[model samples]
Structures are given as C-alpha cells and as structure tokens.
Target chain A: MRGMPVFALGCALALLLAVSAFSDEPARAAGFAWETDYAVALQRAKDEGKPIFLEFR
Target chain B: MRITDLTVVDIGLFDFDADVTLYCFVLNADEQVYLRYGGRDDTSPDAYLNEKSLHAALEKGLDLHGKWKAGELKLPARPAAKKPADYPSVKSEVIDRKQCVHCHHTGSGKTKLAASKGTLDKLKDLWVYPDAANLGLELDADTGITVAKVKGVAKEAGFKAKDEIVKVTGNAVYTWGDLQQRLHEVPHDATSLKFTVRRKGAETELEVTLPEWWRATRIERRSFVHAAEPFPEFWGRELTEDERRKYGVKPGEFGAEVTKFWVKTNAQSAGVQVGDIIYEVDGTRSAPYTGHPALWVRLNRKTGDTIKVKVLRGDKNLEFSFKLRAKAW
Candidate 1:
C-alpha cells in the first residue's frame, strides 16, 4: 500500500516539526524579541533617572 | 544550561542599571534552568533576597528541558521594608488555564513585581506606535486595522499634506479630535466649508463640533496593575513594544491622538475613554485582544464579575456593562 502512504507522509512531517519546535517561545514572544549585546549591552536603563527593577517572566 | 531553577530578583540600584532588569521564566516541563543570585552576606537593608536557592526551585517546578544559560544578573538581599500592597502579587505559579482572546479585562488585570520595597520599574515587552514604527504598520488581523497605517493617513488627511493645511473647515469637522480641534480653532483659517470629513478608506460622513476638552477628564497617575510582559530580557515585569510605544497611547480612528487609561486603586468615579476600543469586558464581546502581553494574563479576578464592554464609538459600536473590578492580589 505504498508503505501505507509513505508511512503517513512520515507521520505528517513529524507532526509539522512538532508544531514548529514548540513555537520558539511563542514566536520570540510574539514580537517582543530581544537579544542585546549592544556590543556588550549594559546601558542598564535611565530613560530619565534610573533605579528600576520589576522583572518577572 | 543545567541546574533547573530561576526566579532571581536582587534589584537595588540608582542609575548604573541603564535600564537593568532581566527575568525570563519559560518553564516547559523537562529539566535544568539555573541562575538565581543575590548576595553580599548582608545583615539586611540591601544584601538582597530571592536567592533562597531560587526559593527551593520555585517550590519545585520550573524545568524547561534544555538550553538555559540565564547568566549575569545582580541585586539581592535588600529585604526589611515590605508593603507595596501586592498588586498582581501572591504567586505559587500554576495557572491551569485562562482564555481572554482580547477584551475581557472586566477582571481588570496587570501588575506583578513582588518583593516589597520602593521604586521598582519595568518596561519589558514594548511596541506602540502612532507616528511611526509598528514596523511601518500593515496589520489588520481581523480589523485591529492599520490598513497600511490607515492608508498612509488617508493619502494625507484626504490628499497629500496639501500645504500642512490651511483649509479643513467648519464646526471644526468630525473626530480626529474634531480635526485636531478644528485646527486649533482656526489657527489662522484657510477656508470655510463643512462636509465634516472622515475618509480614511472612503466612506463619507460629516458632523463636527468638538469642545469641552473633547469630553475631558482623562486622568493619569497610574499603577493599578499595568501588565504587558514577555521579551528578550534586560529587567522584567514586561513593558516593551518600544516600552509600550514610549509610555503608551496608540489609538487611531482618525489620528491626532493621545488617550490612555489603565487605572485602578478605586477607579475614581468611572468616566473612561482614551481611544475607546475595549469591546466587552464585563458583558463579554471583547475585540482585537492581542497586545498587552495578551492582556496581562487576565488579572486573577474577583469581585462580582460582569464587565461586558465594546467601545469604538466612531463608526458606532458602543456597549458596556461594568461590575468586576478586583485583582490586586
């Protein structure tokens, strides 16, 4: 049976590459994409007087 | 890329943070993701905190499977003060499920940066553009419309900057702030007609007369839970869409914009309308629900529950049903 439709088309192309590799973290967090080395990154925020920290992921 | 455990918050700065904040938890059930720190051995005041072995590995849960470096981040051991009144606080982390689709903020969410102290700041997942940069606006996604930035501002308010205008006359013309307040009440007028324009994509209509501060009372002095998380990391608790389009306000139905209101702390006698486009929050119709980190994970919600909303009010589609405003837990 043609190897059962080529083994069901290789298991539907590995289930579409396992749903696109778990959506690379929700498609790089749906456009919030960040990766700053800014060449050594570290500007450490100061859009007018620093002292900011409220991180949660 | 090995020891699964991360939830480090040592924060304690004045300026060298340049904008410093980095918290990225994407735990996908597998194993290994370590990098929690906060030391100076401290006797209090600032040795930092949140490093009790990553709170015993977030109470034994976060595991993501592979690739987790999460290095170079500081500030821990401050402790002592305590009492920011936990808004979006109180977490053990395990949201079994939540679906908002877009406008169900009736539960009124946003705000989660535990660790009681003083000036805490965040600007994580940013993007909000009015003058430029939504990458250049193409978006439509079922009428969240950007239709090429409103047809490039309707070829220019109806036909190329036509001399930065000296002619868009009478009753000060229909919305876009009544043609920017009838061009600032005839900032030296150029014509005198009145067809009451509104042709972004061709659909003629007219009825202009805007004053009374365009229905004033658009307050600000925020912080009733301001959610909008997820990004590459720098310092988290989210806010980057270029930092919510640089302090948020990207509404458009005719432009000449500026309208934002995400208040709480007992919402001072209700009167909200800043680009009005919420669409069912308590009554449940909700529309274009994509931004705001998918609307701050539906704010833990409590209180009477019933926020049916749907405000666009320009092409007319007004509906509201308020009654569910809790979430400061």
Candidate 2:
C-alpha cells in the first residue's frame, strides 16, 4: 500500500513525457507528425533549434 | 524531425513556383533556406519526387543547418519578403473570394501582376522551374542526383551515365529541385555552366554548354499563368505520320492543321481559316517535337508583336501577317 503513490507518480511522468513528445505534432498512424499550422511550427522550430521540413502541396 | 505542411497558411517570403503540385523547403528558424527538395518535369507532377532523394535532402538540410548554427556556413541574404495578398490578382482570384490561397496563387498572382503592369515577358516569364533534362541530363528517378543518361549537350560536355552529380555552378545540390533552381538561374544567354560530379571515386569538373533558349519549357498544363500568354486564337492538331507524309512535313519541323478558330483571333483577321495547315512561324520551322505548332508561336511571340505565319491551304501555299495580342485573364 505504501508503494501505490510512487507507482501513480511514475505513470504520471510517463504520460507527461508522451504528451509532450506529441504536443506540437498531431499524432499519426505512420509517417511524420506534420504540423498543419505554419506559424506554430515556425515557433516550435525556433524554440527547438531544429530545421523545418516544410511542404507546400 | 520537425515537419510542417503549409496548407493552412500564406507562404510569405517563400519563393517557389506554386504551380508545382508539391514542393519542399528546408530552412532554419532564422528562415535561412538551406535547400529545396521538390520539382517536376512537364511529364508528371511528381516526376522528380523520390522518397530516397527527399530523405537525402533532409539529411543534407540538417547538416547545413548544423553547420550554419555552428557558424561554419555562410548563407546569402534572404530575398525580399512578399506575400500573395501583395499582388492584386490574388486579392480578386483568391483572398477577396474568401478562398484559401492555394500554393499556385503566389506564382500566378505575381505573373498576373507583372502582366497587368506590361512587364511580363512571355518568352521568359512563362517558363518557370525548368527541368534538369534541359541540360540533357536525366537524373535517376530514385536517387535524384545520379546521372542515368547523358545525351545532346550533356554528352558533348563529357557527362557520363553513372556519374553522381555533386554540385552545380559550385553550389552543392542534394536533390533534383536544388539543381533545377540553380539551372533556372543561369542567364538566358549563358554559353556554359560549371558542373562538379563524382565520376568513379574522383570529383571531376565539366563545362556544360548551354543551348539557346535553354530556359524555355512547356507551360504547366494546370497553371493559370498560361492565360497571361498571347492567345493564338486558333486550335490545331499535330499531323500524324501519314498526314506528315502527305503534307511533306519533315520529321523535325512543326506542322499542324487548324481545326477551328478558338475565337476571333488575329489569325482570323489575317484570313487564316479552318483547315489551313500551319507549318512555320516568323521564319522558324523547327520545334521541340510537340505536335502542336501553335505552341511555338505562343512560346516565341509576345503581345503587340507582328509576325508572318505560313500555311498550306489545299494545293496552294499561303502566308498571313498578324499582330499577336494578350487575352483577358
């Protein structure tokens, strides 16, 4: 019974990490997590110091 | 790892032919463009599109980005920022209509605006994003930069099949799109281009001779920019092999039978009637082997220019003089 709270906290951390990993990107079954919004993607790119793979189709 | 599909936004400062159905740009947060990764020939919308090539481009883009972040690369100043709404044509055709500004609107808008201002040069302006085939180099459909065939000017330049193209005019190119953009920038009158290729294991430099009108390409069949060109005011079909034999049309010369007058065009004013076989325009007889002779006229002539058109009506050869005019887009 004493480990119950610690177990719940660990699950919460994992869930948090999962959410954050896909926070800016919409989840997809396969392929890339393509951000549909350019402004938001641009901001995220600036924050992450990463290059953007932008497609105009 | 960040991917963005620019469907829900305006492409301000992004310079590309929106007429292409698919296009990609790799850039850093500062909007420093590292490389481009999409292009097409007149044949197909995804002619040069390859998964492996795109992956290669993305990897190179990241490398360029890293070098840039580490101050190991120097990029040119970004081009002046411009938007679709900046052009009046987009306002009426897209923005004012409450339509999502399509990717192509940006290019059509700019060309239409230039047309309205009497600055659009049809001969030069209509040809956008010429293919690498113009250089007589056929790149591998899967790898993008590997030379699959070399003929014409490329063969003469000493380019060989299996040579991996590394750079164009000294600019490193990772994908077909990168090479195309660089080729499009070559001056219309340029006599030669410098190519760096990986032949076997050694990097070799070759000088590629530029054919006249190397920048000219077929107008995209789906683009509205064709509306800005001078209307031939006539429709025609290419002579078939039998018809060519009958008409004495040489294998490489242009020949077409005027099926109908599309509208009251200047050709009609000059007495060009249905059933007239058009064979030459303004003293030029050779064409790119496209069956339609009118294409040559549209590509070579400009609004307000007067030229002589030759045709054969029945057994008598005839000629007509007419002034080319622009159509209301």
Candidate 3:
C-alpha cells in the first residue's frame, strides 16, 4: 500500500515533465490563441456571442 | 480565432475571387460575413496585406458587431451551404491523396469545368474581386480600412475623403473585407451602386453610376487567366509611345516591357528575363491599344495552346515557345 503512493508520485512527476517539454516548444510561444477546430470555434462563437475570425491559408 | 488548412466545403458561400491565397473573414456564427481582410495582386503574400490593415479590419468588425447586436445593422442572408468536396478539383485531389486544392485554384477549376461544358467566354471576368478604387475611393495604405480619398464617381456623387463607408448595397460594411463582400454581390449589369458613409458624426447616402467595364478584373492578377490561357509567368506593363520609340518599335505597335517574373514559374524556367520587351505573340504584332499582352493572351488563346513569343532583349530579338498549363495550384 505504501508502494502504491510512491508509484502515484512517480507517475505525477513523469506527467509534469512531459507537459513541461511540450510547453517549452516554439509553437506554444509563437502561436496565437487560435482554435484549430472549426466546429468547436463556431460553437464557442455562438455561445460567447462573438464573431469568428477565420483564417484560411 | 479559427486557423485552418482543413478543406471546408462551405467556401462557396464566400464567393472568393479564386486567386486568394490568404484570406481572413470576420463573420458571425451563423455565417453572415461582416467583412474580409486579405487580397493580393502579386503572388507575394504581403502584396496587399499587412499587420496594421488586419488590426484595423478586426477593430472595425467588432464595431460592426456591436451595431449588429443592437439591431441597427442588417446583414445579408446567408447562402446555401455546399461542401468543398463537391468541387471537381478538390474531389479529384482528395481521391488521389494529393495535397488539397488551394482556394485560388477553385476559380480556374470552375473555369475549366465551364469550358468543358462548352460555356467559356473570353470577355467574362470569372471570380471578379471588387476594388473600391472602381468607385474612386482610395483606402489608407497602412490600415486599408479607412477612406483616404474619394475622387471621380464617388466624389462626384457627394462622397468626401475620410468618410468611413458604413454600408454598401443595403448591407453594413465595416472594412474593405465587408465592402468587398457587398461589392461581389452587385450584379455585373447594375447601373448604379448605393452606399452610406459616416462623415463628421453623420451618415449620408450616395449613389454612383457603375462604369461599363466595372465587372472586368485585372487579367494579369487573375489565376483563372493563367489557368485557361497561354499566359507568361512574368508580369509586364503596356509600353508607352515614348517607351516604344526608345525600344525602336514603330509607333502604334504593341509591346509589353517585362517588369518582374514570378519565382519558379515557366517564364523563369524558359530563361525569359526581366527588361525583355515582348513585341510579338504567336506571329501577331501585339497591338498596344488592344490591351495588356497577358490579357490579350487570355482573351484569344485556350489552355494547352502553344505560344511563340518574340522578345527584344537589348538590341537582339530572341524567340521563345511556351505551352499553357492547366491551373496547378
């Protein structure tokens, strides 16, 4: 039972490191707060009563 | 903000000018487009787009949104939705697992399809993108959203410089994007255009007559022309009489001075250099008064046609043969 808590701690640390690696990438720094999924963005726009700024390139 | 490279079938609703490579749309969730942001004449992405213009378009879109919410502005009815896969080029590309058909290619693809259906017309300007300059309204170079000058028809119709165009053809317009949308909806044969402008805290209505060739687009910039006609991959301007004289060409003869060549195009591949004067195309002495050489090719030649061009490079006259290729974008 004591080893179980230690395993959980190890798993949490691994997850944290994995997330840190991802967060440090250049894409995260330079990327705008743009949603890539159109359906989700459209729903959010409707819910928030906002217009969609759609960039198609 | 929605950034996407995914092929959305609903692009038909926008009725884009086909050659648009980068396009930004400000619209409601219901697909009522408030305006658009990007347009290009040259192949370069930054040709008519800049950070300041995009920012101004966004600000104006938000302002228009406010009016829309307050019921003060009415937007046009949304078009029936059609999937992009329904487009022939897109469908073929998707089935072949090739790269998605670009937005600009849609116009030429449609033109080719029309040609296959025996309905090709040289005079028709397929996918005409509207420029406010047609109405004599010059937009600010930096912002591209504000009115910098109103001359000719717009000025004669009581429009003044600095008057922000608030509505066009009964639809609210906040930026050039919105203005373009409204203008696109205008019938090619429409005799007049109605617009409302905000000037000095008041909105005024004005109407202007449409020019005869108002529906005609700049052929050099149109991808549809490149797709369907035997066109050079370089851009050139019609030579003035003085330029013709300097080039040793007879007066009233047509010649186009090559100014720039798009990178990686057939012109560059064929060793067609800048500063070369195109004096003849396919044995025809290109008449200067007829129109631009590129436009002349678009009007006369069909796709797959081979064109023999004579260029005066310095004092030497050189000849080159170029084949028209289908739209590759």
Candidate 4:
C-alpha cells in the first residue's frame, strides 16, 4: 500500500531520534572511566571498521 | 515481555586506572538478575558456592541457590534471612531503559520481565564504544599524541575523529579537554588556542597546538556526566546478570561495587561497621574507587598518602578517620 513508504519514513525518523538520544557523553572529564571487561568490544569495533564512541555508563 | 539477549559491552581503562580500580556493569532494558561479588583471589569455598559466575535467565537463576546446579554458574549457600523473600522486593535492581514491542512476553517462572534486554535503561549513562585499533592512538607514550603544529586551520573533525585529515597540523589529542574543545567549537582553520581554562586561581588562555589528524578505528564509551556533586547518584544501574549474557558485562566479576566499609585484615576491632559506601577520600570528593576494601585505611596516592573515608551506612553518611600504614588497633 502507499502507506508503506510513509510508515518506513516514520520508522527511520524514530530510529534516528533514538540513536541521538542515547549518544550523550557522561561528562567524565574530571573523573576516571570505570575500567572493565570491555576489551572485546574494543577489538570488535576495530574489525567492523566503525568509530567506537567510548562512553561510560 | 521476554527480557532477552544479555551481553558484554567492553573492558576499558581510565586516567585513574594507573593504580585505581573502577568497573561498571551494563544490561539491556529488562532481565533483573542477581549478582554476587567475589574476588579472583578469595581461596575459600564461599567463592564457589556463592554463585561466582554469570547467571543469565536469572528468572531461572534463583533456583540455583543451593547445590552446584545448571550451566557453568554455581550457586552460593543461601543465607538465613529475617524473612524469606520468595517474591523479593527487587529493590536494589538498576533499570537503565524500558522494554520495546519486539520483546517476548512470559508468565511467573515463565513470566517475562516488564522490559526487554535489548535496549539500555539509562542509555545516556551506559555503553562501551568498540575500539578501532589495538592501540587506537599510535603516538609515543612519553611525548603523547605527537603534535606537529600546523599554520592554517584544517577541517576540524569535531569529536568525530575517525579518519585522518588532509589539512593537518599538530599532535593527536587523547583527552577532549581544552585544546580539542576549542578546535571543535571555534573553527576548523584554527591558528591558535582561543579558549579560557579555569585553573587553581584564575582563567588562563593557553595556546594549544593542533597536530596533523591521524585516523583510526578508535572506540569511545557512551557515558553521561552524572553530576555526582556527591557520587551516590551514580549507583543502581550496574551491570546485571542478564546484561552479562549479551554485552558481556560479566556477572559476579566484581567490576565495581559500593565500598561498604574496609576493616583492616589485621585490625581486630577498628570500631568500623560494614555497609558504608565511600563518599570522599581525604577531602577531594572521592575519586574513582579501587576494589580494595581497606583502601581508605591506606595512602591515597603519590602525594596525599593519608586517607579519611566519608561514606553512607544506611541512615548516616558517617566520617571515618584513619591513616594509611600508620594505624593502631
């Protein structure tokens, strides 16, 4: 139906908004980032060729 | 909904990591599970029987309380409770985000959690960005990001510094402090540092040189600056067991926990009770905490060795005064 394109566009916009909302930096400027078993993700990001935005939750 | 897919985010190092110990646990939207904190060196049977490994599907995890049961995970001896919490309050559990439509539904035993394990509750506060290279920044450690100051302002690649820039000039920046902040907000063709830095007494305009841009697949963690004027605001949403299933936020791994209280291994009667979460060390609004229990009873760092811990023990955030090494029973 013609509604498919409109629906897809809506979904795309929602996804974009979701990604942006989650892309915040936890102003850890003065403190230290908690270290953990994050080495694997670091390695994977390397493999996938993506810019790993390291954020501390 | 069926809280699904728990996994590990990443393992990272921070500035205080030089001698400090700090860790975090992250889970998706749903799946509230139980986590027991044990050490790698605790040679007692308590470590094993206490459910040391990651236990996903914690809805099924509680059943493993006694006798070494299913999977790689072992259950710890259940402690005698004042009252059996069959329907435990789930009070201390951390919720970062909510569940979505794709999540499956279930009933008690099979009853699905109210949320999904796909998303992060406080997505703004949690996550680990994958790394681009083994060592993302390939600069000489001693000299740092290797700056080669240039003349004109090349294309300032905001914080999105992935690929190397052609119109390059200075060194590679490790921290997003002043120099990088200026380059980001000012203009791409920046000739000098035109930003003010708040130091001890006054705001000074320091000149920071930008080196040629080097691009690599570096990993950045998704972290939020939780205004912890007092750090208690940053607890709760630690890595849960279900989360361990997906992002590998390893369960029972002793990533990071509140320092209840540290009784010197030798201090028979230091008059300090357990259950105190440290708030401050010496006077500097407590820094990233190392996993040592009796840490406050020791020296702080290279300079301020003596430490005094300010912690919250339930109703009161008491102040415990103790000096490192030079302590008496």
Candidate 5:
C-alpha cells in the first residue's frame, strides 16, 4: 500500500514535467521572468503603473 | 539584465516589419510606444544594436513612463492596427482553432497574401522600420532621450546637439519609440517633416524637407519572398570587377557572389554552396534591379516557375534548374 502511494507520486511528478516541457512559453531569461500571456502582462502593467518591455524574437 | 523585475511580455498582435528578426518595444499600459530598441543591417546586428544600446533604450523607456505618469508628457494615438488572424494564411487558425497565431509567422503570412494577389511589389519597403538615425538625429544610446548629435534632415532643420526633440509631426515624442511610431505613420511618399525641439529651455519649431527616394529601404531589412528557387537560398553582394575578370566575364557584366546560403532549402537540395558566383538566370545576363540577385528573382518569378541558373563554383561552371516554391518559414 505504501509502494502504491509512492508510485502515484512518481506518476504525478512525471505528468507535471511533461506538461512543463510542452508549454509554449519560452525559457526565462536570467534576470526577467517574462510573462508569456500578453493580456496578463498588460493588466499587470496597468496595475503597477509600469511600462511594458515587450520582446519579439 | 537591467530590465529585470519589469513587466516583460513575449507576444502581442503588433505588426512588425517583415525583416525584423528581433525587436524590443517599450510601451505603457495604454499602448503608447516609447521607443524601439533594435535595428540591423545586411552584415551584422552590431550596426544598430548592442547590449549597451539596449540598456540605454530601457532607461529611456522608464524615464518616459515616469514623465507620462507625472503629466509632464502626453503620447500620441497609435496607428491603425491589424489582427494576425485577418491574414489569409492564418485565418483558419483564428477561426477554427481560436488560438493566437505565432508572432514570427505574421510577416510570412502577410507576404503570402501579397503573393497571392500578384502584388508582391507592394511588399517592397512594406512596414518600413523607422530609426532616429534615418533622419540624422543620433540619440544617446544609454538615455535614448537627449539628442547627442544631428545630421541629415534634422541638421538641415537647424537642430543642434543636446537639443531634445519634444514632438515629431505634432505628436509628443518622449522616447525613440514614440518617434518611431510617428515616423511609421509617415506616408511612403512624404517629402517633409516638422519637429519641435527644446534647446536650452527654449522651444523652437523647424521643418525639414526629405529628399526623393526617402522611401528607398535597405533590402536586407525588408521581409519579402526570398526563397523562390531556382533562385539560390543565399544573400550576396555585387561581384567586384576583379572577380568578374577572374571568372572570364566581360566588363559591365552583372553577377553576385554568394555570401550565405540557408539550410534545408532548394538551394541546398540543388547543391548550391557558399562562394558560388551566380551570373545568369533564364539566359538573362543580369538585370539586378534589386541590389541582391535573390530579390531580383523573387520579384520576377512566380511559384512553380522552373528557372535555369548558372553558378560559377570555384573553377567550375555549374548550372542548376529548379522550380520556385513558397518559403517554408
């Protein structure tokens, strides 16, 4: 029964990694944690009263 | 690295020039662009961009944002916008899949639509990427606000060093991004611009007339059909006189020496290699209306048109015949 619980945890970990690997978001740069969603970034900019540094590469 | 902890977004519906490989825009929440931070030439990215320059652009963006918040500056309205899904190539995705299209493919899709309309010439200088240097106004790369020097149109208008441009074409320009936006709205046939400058705390206005061919753009910085093969998948410069003589070509002959070739294209499939000299296509000696021979092919040929090409590879005179196709992105 304990082994079953550990196996479930392993499956969950693998699923999480698989989902992350398939994410469309690019790898984060060294200093900035770039927001992949444009709407979210725009809203955040408005809330923080900040300008957005948008990059297209 | 200096842009750390700032709000950075990786995607948007913004329509950029086709040739822009990478670009940065600093803008407020209301979508008022402050300035642009990227430009490149045929040879290298170093011509218009570097780490120091980008840092300068970031700082300028922040300064402008602060000024805008403090009511010291007012930004102009953005130009007419277009959605990526409106493009024919990606319409299906926008309608059926209901997903945001990839930013990189936007240019390609737009080009495809132009090709379909047989109006590829419209693609020439399409969405000309503007820079302050085009007007002879060199901004400080670190601050991106103060005009370090002026030349060309800016100089002819009596602009002096350290003169801060407060407005361009009647639009408030707090940073290079704002200036670029105003310039982008300039019609291709526009022959003049008006500027408001703040010099020594005194405001003055000046008008500068642009020379004809101001719309002429650098071919390398444009996005158009490039992979229409038997056109080589490469970029080259006009062959030198000595190079023509060494290849046994007569004087006044037209040819270009290959400098770079793209991988996995028909050029590679047909065994075209770098350093090959392309002299003729379809028995035409050389009609290089465009500086680059490949662009000439693109403007003249259509998809599936089989063309005969003559390439001088080292000491061997080689020939290639291939059909043109749409670029594979």
Candidate 6:
C-alpha cells in the first residue's frame, strides 16, 4: 500500500548510508593497516624507515 | 611497513600483465623494487598464489630493507616516472572520457596505439609474463620455488621433484615472482638457462636447454592485445593422452586433431582438412610447454607469412603450406 513505498524508500536510504560508512575505509587485519594513497604511504614508509607492500588489483 | 592498496591508479612504472587479478611489489620509499610477489598462468588467476610465498617474500623484503639501510644494498637506478596522464593514448582513452585510469588501460591503450601504427610485434607482444612451467618445472605453490614436478627439458636436464631452487644464473630467488621475473629476462633466442638448486641440503647446478617457442605462453587470456593477433583460421582439439600414446606421439611434440576450419580461410584452401592430426608447423613440433599448438600458430605466425603445416591422416603423413591471413576483427 502507500505505507509500503515509504518503508522501501527508508530501507534504500539506510542501505546507502550503510555502504558509505565502510566504502572509504581501507581494509586492516592482524595489526597490518592498508593505505589507499600511494604518496602518503611512501611518505610514511620513509618516516618509519621501512619498505612498502604495494598491492594492485 | 605499510600495505598500500591501489585502485584507479596509473600503473605506468609498475606495469605487469594486466590480466592478473592481483599483483604485489615490495619496494622502498625511493621506488626501488625489492621483489615482486604475484603471477599466474592461464590455469587460474590464483594459480600461483600462496600465503607462505608472500610471507617468504616479505621476510626477504625486510632483509633487503636492512641491507639498504646499512648502505650495503645496491639497486639499479629507478626508471623515470611516467603516468597515464603523460601517455597520449591513455589520455584520450581514459582521461578524456572522465573515467578512472585503470591498471589495464595502460597496456590496452599502448597496444592499440602500437597496432594502429603498424609497429606492434604480434608474436613478442602477446607473450607477456611467461609461465615457469615452460622450463619444465612446476614449483610447489606453498614452498616458493620447491620443484614439485619436473618434465620435458628440466627432466632431461636432471631436475628432480623436491629440488629447492635457490638461484637463477647465480641471482638468488625467494619466490615464484622472483623466479618468473628472471624468466621474463630470458632472450627469445637464448639456448639454455642455469639453475642453482638445493637438493637434500646440497647445492646442485643444472642447465636447462631452451626449445623453440619456449617463450610462448597462453595469450587467449590476455585481453589487452590478443584480439589483435592473427588467428590460425583452424580449430584444433588436443589429442587425449590415450590418443597420443596410441598414435605414438613423442614427448615435446604438438599432438592435436584439426576439428574445423573457418570458412574461406587460406588453411581450408590449402587442403588442411578436418580430422587431420597436425603435428608440426613451420618446422616447430610443439607449442610452449603446456600450450596448445593451434595457439602457437597464432602467436608465432603473422599475416603474409608462408606456413608449412604437417599433419597425419589415416596412417599417411601429409603437408600443406598456406599464406597466413589477418583475422577479421
């Protein structure tokens, strides 16, 4: 009915909000953090005196 | 120390086989590549992937990092930085369209531009990221370069299963990517390769002879430029093991039966009939190790090249020569 349409729209908006929350965040696991910006990662590597693990997909 | 995840980036200096779903580079802040970590054959995208191999590569990366810090490691000067924005083809294809510059765009755009300019070496261009199996060695995925199986040339050269590969021509290799990177440097006309392997805790050096078309790989999966390759105009079905043994087909020879020919092709006109067992082409007996012979024809032969195909039909050996034609796009 009329209420069902509004309910579906509410659900769609909720889903969009849910996706946006995690979309920009890079993945991290087991104390290893992933950075999306290569320049920033390179800067961090130089500061920390370490090598980079660059993965391309 | 950081795991940098790249998406929608210009893969100019880091160019690899774009067909690969995942690839890794262990490098320093100065962009000096310490090691590469991912590669695959035509079997599957993750065919050579192993967590243990990555761990091994990372450990070696740390060692290189230490050496670099101590000023003991000497790496070649970094290549000049080039971005997709600098390439005309990429600029027009991706940048002009407001699309994200994909890793594959670099390869596809450059190849398309090369083809248009009539400068693309079809054979050499198609054979990218040659598989290690071409050397007749199948390294165990879990243990880096530990040889799990050996056949053909490596077997003939005394390579055995469980032999742990330590170096390629004296350069230490710690992972499949490292080994493949060395194989990538092999010249097309090079006759042999030297391998230093640790077997039963003893280092042994062996030489593997390179065969004709050894650099050839399965190109059908390489979407960037395979369509530009001239097709062979004939479909061939690989002869089953039983059929090959029954026909007394020798090892290191292409054993396939021509199933059909495209209509009006020079192959059909040259008297290459269906059901003919094609064993050789242009004096070459087989494709690269584990590759189909029909693909060999496509990768090695070009349009206007006169090809001599040898076949077997009902206990009779026959030969046919045809002018290769450009495949219709």
Deviating ranges (above 4 Å) for candidate 1: A1-57, B1-6, B9-136, B139-150, B154-329
Model 6's DockQ score: 0.22
User: What are the candidates' C-alpha RMSDs?
Assistant: 22.0, 9.2, 10.4, 23.6, 10.7, 9.6
Q: Alpha-carbon error at B138 in model 4, in Å?
A: 16
Please identify model 4 stretches exceeding 4 Å from their true place: A1-57, B1-162, B165-263, B266-269, B272-274, B286-306, B326-329
Tell me the lDDT of model 6 at B83.
Answer: 69
Question: TM-scores for chain A, candidates in order?
Answer: 0.22, 0.44, 0.43, 0.32, 0.46, 0.45
* TM-score of candidate 2 relative to the true fold: 0.76
Q: lDDT per residue, candidate 2, A1-57, as tens digits?
A: 111111111221211111112111234323234465566766877777777777665
Assess each model's interface with DockQ, reporting 2 decimals per model.
Answer: 0.07, 0.22, 0.25, 0.04, 0.19, 0.22
Shift of residue B262 alpha carbon in model 4, Å: 9.9
- In candidate 2 the C-alpha lDDT for residue B11 amounts to 58
Clashes of each: 50, 0, 6, 63, 5, 0
lDDT of 2 by residue, B213-236 (tens): 676565635355455667665677
lDDT of 6 by residue, B4-27 (tens): 222334454575666666677777
> lDDT per residue, candidate 5, B108-183, as tens digits?
5666676677665644444355666767878765445578988887788898999888878887665454565567
Indicate which candidate wins on lDDT: 2
lDDT of 1 at B266: 26
Error of 3 at B183 (Å): 2.7
Q: Tell me the spans in candidate 2 whose CA falls farther than 4 Å from its real position.
A: A1-33, B1-12, B220-225, B236-248, B257-277, B281-284, B287-291, B299-325
lDDT over C-alpha atoms for residue B50 of model 1? 28
State residue B189's C-alpha deviation in candidate 2, in Å. Answer: 3.3
Question: What clash pairs does model 2 have?
Answer: none
Q: What is the C-alpha lDDT of each candidate?
A: 0.24, 0.71, 0.65, 0.24, 0.59, 0.70
Better of 1 and 2 by TM-score: 2
Q: With candidate 1 superimposed using the best TM-score fit, by how many Å does residue B25's alpha carbon deviate from the native?
A: 13
TM-score head-to-head 1 vs 3, winner: 3
TM-score of each: 0.19, 0.76, 0.72, 0.22, 0.63, 0.68
Summarize candidate 1's per-residue lDDT along B1-329 as a digit string, tens digits: 11111212111211011111222221221211222221111122111222232232232212211222233322133334321121233222211123211111211122334213322222211111011111122322221112324233233334221111111443312112112233333322222223333334443432233221221111111222343222101111223345335433253111111143334422212433545434234433322223321132243233454444444445666654445443432
lDDT of 1 at B52: 32
